[model samples]
Target: MINITLPDGSVKQVSKGSNALDLARQISEGLARNVLAAKVNGKVIDATLPLYEDAHLTLLTWNDPEGKSTMWHSSAHLMAEAIELLYPGVKFGIGPDIENGFYYDIDFCDYDISEKDFSKIEKKILELAKEKQTYQRKEVSKADALDYFSKKGDEYKLELIQDLEDGQITFYKSGQFTDLCRGPHIPNTGFIKAVKLTKVAGAYWRGDENRKQLTRIYGITFPKKKELTAYLEMLEEAKKRDHRVLGKELGLFTFSQKVGLGLPLWLPRGAVLREQLEQYLKRVQKEAGYEPVITPHIGNVNLYKTSGHYQKYGEESFKPIKTPVEGEEFFLKPMNCPHHCEIFNSSPHSYKELPIRYAEFGTVYRYEQSGELHGLTRVRGFTQDDAHIFCTPDQIKSEFNGVIDIVQQIFTAFNFNDVIIQISLRDPQHPEKYIGSDENWEKAENAIKEVAEERGLNAIVEYGEAAFYGPKMDFMVRDAIGRKWQLGTIQVDYNLPERFDLTYIGADNEKHRPVMIHRAPFGSMERFVAVLIEHCGGNFPLWLSPDQAIILPISEKYQNYAEKVLLLLKKHEIRTVIDDRSEKTGRKIRDAELKKIPYMLIVGEKEEASGSVSVRKHGEGDLGTFSIEDFAQKINSEVNKLINY
Candidate 1:
């Protein structure tokens, strides 16, 4: 008998050859029926894979992320089968499950596919899914795999197999379709009761732009039709909340092909919104013992080389700018931490002066592919509300907790109550992919996990998701429409200090390395503002709105009184504007509503003399009339409630 430890810490003695499905059966039949996959000693595998030794097993159902991934992966195979049936002689590149769904890249020679074919493909997928074909995994030798695909005249599979070792190659076969895969697939296709092909796009063979562009089909699947229907509804809502659509509607930001793709031009209104967000964080950072600093947009090439960024991301970075002087090269700064590291190294320090927090709204540039660019969310240039805390190793946890508090405060103020925390760690198998000593890596990972637990955060741990330098914690906020966006991050690094040879004198008068804590509550000004616009549906909170209130004149008669009201509101520091255009009151109101202005103050002939203004709230309709002072006081109170320094 071998020992199998369940997630709840229960140890069960089972036969040596018992598979994960057998273990689930021992637990409960209902659990067995729901089990889509299993995690064996942290590695996800088929539920039917037999275990012959002591192992830690976690049975995965639809509720677990791994289970969902397995289901989606199986759905991809099912999709491939459907696509093959619909289009014969189609060669596939890769089909993997993504965050929301799965996508398959296919080289359909002389064949055309578009959104119009989505229904037929989705129908085919569902029809195959009902067939209840079991996904059977089979290991194949490199030569055998080559023979299989070569006989089928698929050069794509041949190219893939060329890099894979003989013993490591595996193929998964379901129904009449078979494909090479390293999988933890669902038990059967029947689990995918509903399927939807979401989009069709063009992708390079291996994401290399120079390679042949293939047709990429994106899709999503669910175990229940009702769930699929709800997901479609959410997709519709997400479309309405799309930042690109809202940005144009509210005149927040814009992109110009002439200026360049993936670069945003912040209009006046958008600039005001960004400035308000920055000022809000600036105030919070001041209270939290942070000193603001500024850095240049370009840095010496040697700076990145010394930070090891050049070694890892040199090719991805924009080519260095050359100068008249030989060997003089500079680059648009890709990150802020390296410059901050130089700042810390500028002077000597002692343990007493530890935890030096350097904050900057630093703008940086990256060379993002045009296809990947999406409004402000994925941009070539953006400013990060970045900071680096240089502290003693003993102070890491405390500093991390402090950063968490600030993040929570900012999210709460922005009404992002549904926050999901994710702890990303390095992959153990690929130790060379990361820098820093094993001891420091352990220290950083544990510090993050402990702080997350102590703070009682709703956090999930994911491996192989860490920055190449260190482990980190990221906060994903769900907007009003239930779409999640990564907003905040705190990374613990021990590599940079060692790279820069930064030191601080301890109580023993011995030189010690200061641990570095890199954090950004708002990942970037552009992305944060974009998310904010969508989250609030452009009806920004009183404190953050670019134009909180608009003064409307019933006619040319009350224009003076409208100006008077606006002056008073501006005196009270409310962001108010006057719609003095010679248009009907209804048209003005409709325009203001479309702009998502929070409040509209209408002054007519009677109100101009009575010293009162008619008030209307956006989306909520009229809130009756109030004296100018009363309205100003009400707006001030609401703003103060949302933003308190």
Candidate 2:
């Protein structure tokens, strides 16, 4: 018998060669039925894979993210099988599960496919799923893999196999379709009760722009049909809340092809909104003992070379600008940390002045692919709410905990109550991907882990998700509609300080390198505003609203009253606007609602005579009447309540 440790810390002695499904059966039949996969010693694998020795096992159901990933991976195979059956001689490149769904790239020979064919493909997938075909996994030699695909005349599979080693190659076969995969798949196709092919687009093979463009089909699946129905409803709601659509409707931001792709033009209202966010963060940083700094838009290429960023990300940066002098070149700044490091080195520091924190709202540029750019979320030019802290190694945890406090306050103020904290560490198998010594990496990684433990954060550790320089504490916040967005990040870096040759006079009268902490509560102004737009559906908090209230005159007769009311609100420092258009009162109210303004102050003869206004709240109409002074006090009270943090 071998000992299997369950997640609840229960040890069960079972027969050797028993798998996770068997263990689940021992626990409860219902659990076994729900089990889609299992995590063995931190690696997700098939529930049917037999265990040869003692192992730690965690049964994964639909509730677990890995279980969902396994189901989606299996559904991809099912999708490929369905498409292959429907359209013969179609060669596939790759299909993998993404955050929301799965997509497959296919080189369809002599056949044109589009979104119109999605229904038929989905129908075929469902039909094949009902067959309950078990997914069979087999290890194949590299030569055998190449020969099989060669016989099938698929160059994409051959190219993929050339990079893979002999013993590491594996193929998963379900129904009449088989493909190369390193898989942790579901038990059977029956787990996919519902399937939806969302989109079809052109994708270059292996993301190489110079290569052949193949048809890529995107899809999603669920175990139950009702769940799919609910997902579709949520998708419809998402469309309505999409920032690109609402940004234009609310006059927040825009883009133009003449200027450039992936660059946003912030309008007047949008600038005010962004400025408010910046001011709020500035106040918070001031209270936390942080000093502001500024950096240029361009930096000498050697600056990045010294910081190791150019070595890692040179290809993604915009082309360097060459001066009249042959060797002198400057590149658009890809990161702000390198410049900040130089600033720290410019002045000598002593141990008494350790823990220096520098903050900047620095704008940086990157050359993102045209196809990948999406409104404000993925932009070429964006500003980061970046800050760097230089402290002794012993103070790492306290500084990290302090940053976490600030992050929590920001999230609380924004109503992002549900957040997923991720502790990202380096991948042990690929040490070459990171800089710095093992000792430094260990110290940095341990600091974050200890901080998470001390803070009692229910965080998940994700291997290989760390930045190239160090480990990261990432915040994945769920929006009001349940969509997850990575909003904040804090990284511990010992590498950049070493590369920059930064040091401080220690208490022992010796020079020592100071550890660097890189943090951004709002990852980028563009992306944060995009997420905020979608999260609140453009109805910003009273404190952050571009125009907190708009005075709408009921008719031409109340135009004087509207201006007087606006002036009074302005005196109170409330962001207010006047709507003196000749349009009807109802039309003005409707337009104001569309803009998502927080409050509508309706002024008429009665309100003018009484020196008051009829107020209506967005999404909750009829807030009753209030005197002008009383309304100003009310708005200030609400803003104070939100900005108290």
Candidate 3:
């Protein structure tokens, strides 16, 4: 018998050559039925694979993220099988599982496919899924893999195979269809009860624009029919809350081809929303003993080179600007930390002033591929709510904890209570992917891990997700609609300080390198606003709303009363706008509702005579009537309640 350790610290005595599924069956048949995959010794693999030695095991079900990913990945294979049966000789590029579901890129040569065929394809997928087909994994030599795809006229697979070594290549076959994949698939096809082919789009073969474009069919599958139905409904709701659509409808931001591809132009209303967020963060940082600083949009290329950013990210950065003076070249800043490091270097520091925090709302630019450029989320140019703390090694934990507190405050104020804290560490297998010595990397990673434990934070550790310079802790927030967004990040970096030769005189009267902590509560203003717009569905919190209240006169007769009410509300610092348009009262109210204003104040003959305003809350109409002072107090009170933290 061999000992298998479970996640809860229980040990199971199992016979040699027993698989994870056998262990699950030994525990309970019900658990074995739900088991999709297994994690052995921290590596996810097929549950049916035989275990030769004692190992740590975690039985993964649909509830576990890895289990869901494995299911979806198998579902992608199912999808490809269905498509192949329907359209003979349909060459496939790559099929992989995504965040929500899975997609397969195909070179649908000479075949016309569109959204109209989604139902047909989905029907075929469910038909194959009911067959109880088991996915068979096979290890193939590189030569064998290449010959198989080359004979099938699939250059895409052949090209992918060339990158793999003989022993490292694997292929998964299910339901008369086989493809190259490194997989931990679900046990069988019968596990998928419902299937939905969401959409189809054209994508370049490997994200290279110069490569041939293929049809990318996106899909999602669920174990139960009801879950699929609920997911479809949520998707419909998501379309209505899509930031790009709502951002334009609410007059927040826009883009133009003449201006640029990924650069966003914030309108007046959008600027106000962004400014409110900035001012709030600025106030919070000021209270936390942070000194604000400014940096130019462009910096000398050598600045990034000295900080090791250019060497790591030079290809992704915007092209350097050539100056009339030959060798002097400037590049649009891709990061704020390098410039801040230079600022820190300009001034000498002593141990007495060790923990120096510099904050900036710095705009940076990058060269995002045109195809990958999204409205605000994936943009070429955006501003980061960036700050860097330079402190002694001993103070790393306290300063790190302080930043976490600030991050929590931001999340609380924004109503992002459902947050997942992830501690990202470098991949031990690929140390060459990152800069810095192993010693510095270990110190940085350990500091973050220690801080998380001391703070009692439930953070998941992910390998190979850290920034090139250091390990990081990222906050992934699930929005109101259950979509996850990575909103905040805090990184511990000993590399940059060493690379920049930054030093401070210690209490021992000796020069020592200060550890750097890079943080951004709002990772980027554009992405945050986009997530915020969708999180609240454009109904912003009272404190963050562009216009807290709009005064709508019943007619031109009460326009003066509207102005009076607005003035009174402005006295209490309420953001109020008067809708004196020649439109009807109902029309004005409807327009304001569409704009997602928090409160609508109506001034008519009675309101004017009584020196009061009628209130109607957005999404919850009719709050009766109140005096201007009472109404102002109500708005201010609500705003204070949200921003008190």
Candidate 4:
């Protein structure tokens, strides 16, 4: 008998070979039926994998994200199995689970695949799923793996095998299909009740443009048919809310060939929106005792080398610029921290002033592949709401707690109440992937976790997701349509200070190293604004709206009244605009509504007599007439409520 520790702190004495499925059955048959996978120690694995020694185990069900990922990954195998049956002699490339679903790349030698083939493929997938074929895993030697794929004439599989080590190889077989994978799959194909092949696209082999292009089939699966139906409906709604489409329709931002790809041009309205967001944060940062600073767009190449960013990210950075001063090369700044480090080095400091905070809205550049660039979300140029806090070891916790408060404050204003927090740490198995001393890493990681616990944040810990220089805390927020996005992040670093040789005189009059906290509540201005547009469907909050209200004259005779109302709104510090077009009242209102203006003030002969204006709210009918002062007061009340934080 061996000791197995369950998640609830219970120790069970079971046979050494007992699997997670067996343990779940012992607890309750219902749990066993729902168990899709299990987390053994810290790694996720199949529920059917046998235990060889004492271990810690947590059974994963459909409700868990890992469990859902396992199911989706297994569904990809099921789809491939169906394709293999329907069209023999088809070679497989790679199949992976994406954010929404699973997709498989296939090298169809002589068979043509397109959208017309999706229905039959989806039907065949459901048929194979009902057969309840068990997914089996097998550990194979490198030689055996090569021989198997070699006989099948699959160069893709052989190429993948070449990079992996001998003892780490594993293959999973489901139904009549077998593939090379390092997998934690669902128990059987029966877990998938509904299947949909969403689209067919072209993808180069291994994402290399020089390689042969293959047909990539995208798909999704659900445990219940009703869930699949709901997902399909959400997909339709998401299409309507897609940021790229909404950004263009709403005139927020755009890209041009002359301006270059992946670099967005903020239109007048979008520029105002971006400035408002920046001013909001600037106000909050000022209140938090942060000093604003600015840095140039380029930095000496040696600056990044000292901060260790160049060594880790040099390949992804643009080629360095050589100056007339030979051997003095500069690169468009890829990060702001290195320049900030030099700023700290410029002034000597003592422990009495340990926690010095500097903030900047710094623009950084990266070399992103043209294929990977989406709208503003995945851009080559972006500005970070970046800040760095240099604090003593004893002050680390309080500074971290304050950063959390800022993130919470930002979320409150945006009404983003649905947030998932994650504490990301380095992988213990791969120590070489990270920098910094073990002692410093332990201190930084402990400071973050302890602060989170003290603040009562139920943050999940994920290993192998940390930055190379430090551990980080990431905020994953769900948008209006239930899509998850990583918005804000806070990182604790001990490596950069040491690399830059930064120090402060301690209270004991001895030189000591200071801990660095790197934070960005908005992550990036472009990405945040993009998400905000999609979240509210282009109907912005009053304070952030491009045009708070538009004054429409009922007729050419009432133009004077409309102009008077607009002046009064502007005097009240409202973002007001005038619509003096020759169109009728109805056309003006319709145009204003389509522009997503928050309020429309209609001025006519009645307003000219009563000195009052009729107000119409966007997405709603008329809000009745009010004096100009009263309307401004109403707008002020709503905007003040949102900005009170």
The backbone clash count of each candidate, in order, is: 0, 0, 0, 0
Candidate 1 per-residue C-alpha lDDT over 155-211 given as tens digits, one digit per residue, 9 for 90 to 100: 998999999987999999999999999998988888898888888999999999899
List, residue by residue over 220-251, the lDDT tens digit for candidate 4: 89899999999989889888888898888878
In candidate 2, stretches whose alpha carbon ends up further than 4 angstroms from where it belongs are 1-67, 130-175, 178-191, 202-214, 308-316, 322-328, 429-439
Q: Model 2 clash pairs?
A: none
| Model 2: per-residue Cα lDDT over 1-645, one tens digit each | 999999899998889999898999998998888899999999999998889899999999999999999999898899999999999999999999998889999999899898889999999999999999988889999999999999999999999999998899999999999899999899888889998899999999999989999999999999999999999999999999999998998888999999899999999999999999999999999999899999999999899889877888888789899888787889899889899999999999998997999999999999998888998999999999999999988788889999999999999999999999999999989999998778878887898899899889989999999988789999989999999999999998878899999999998999999999999999999999999999998889999999999999989999988898998999999999988899998999999998888999999989999999999998899899999999999999999999875
Q: lDDT of model 4 at residue 200? A: 92
Q: Which ten residues in a row have the lowest lDDT in candidate 2?
A: 307-316
What does candidate 4 score on TM?
A: 0.83
**lDDT (10s digit) by residue, model 3, range 541-575:** 99888899999998999888888888888889899
Number of the candidate with higher lDDT, 2 or 3: 2
Query: Candidate 3: misplaced stretches above 4 Å?
Result: 1-71, 91-94, 105-117, 130-175, 178-193, 201-216, 310-316, 322-328, 429-440
Most accurate candidate by lDDT:
2
Q: Report every candidate's CA lDDT.
A: 0.91, 0.92, 0.92, 0.91
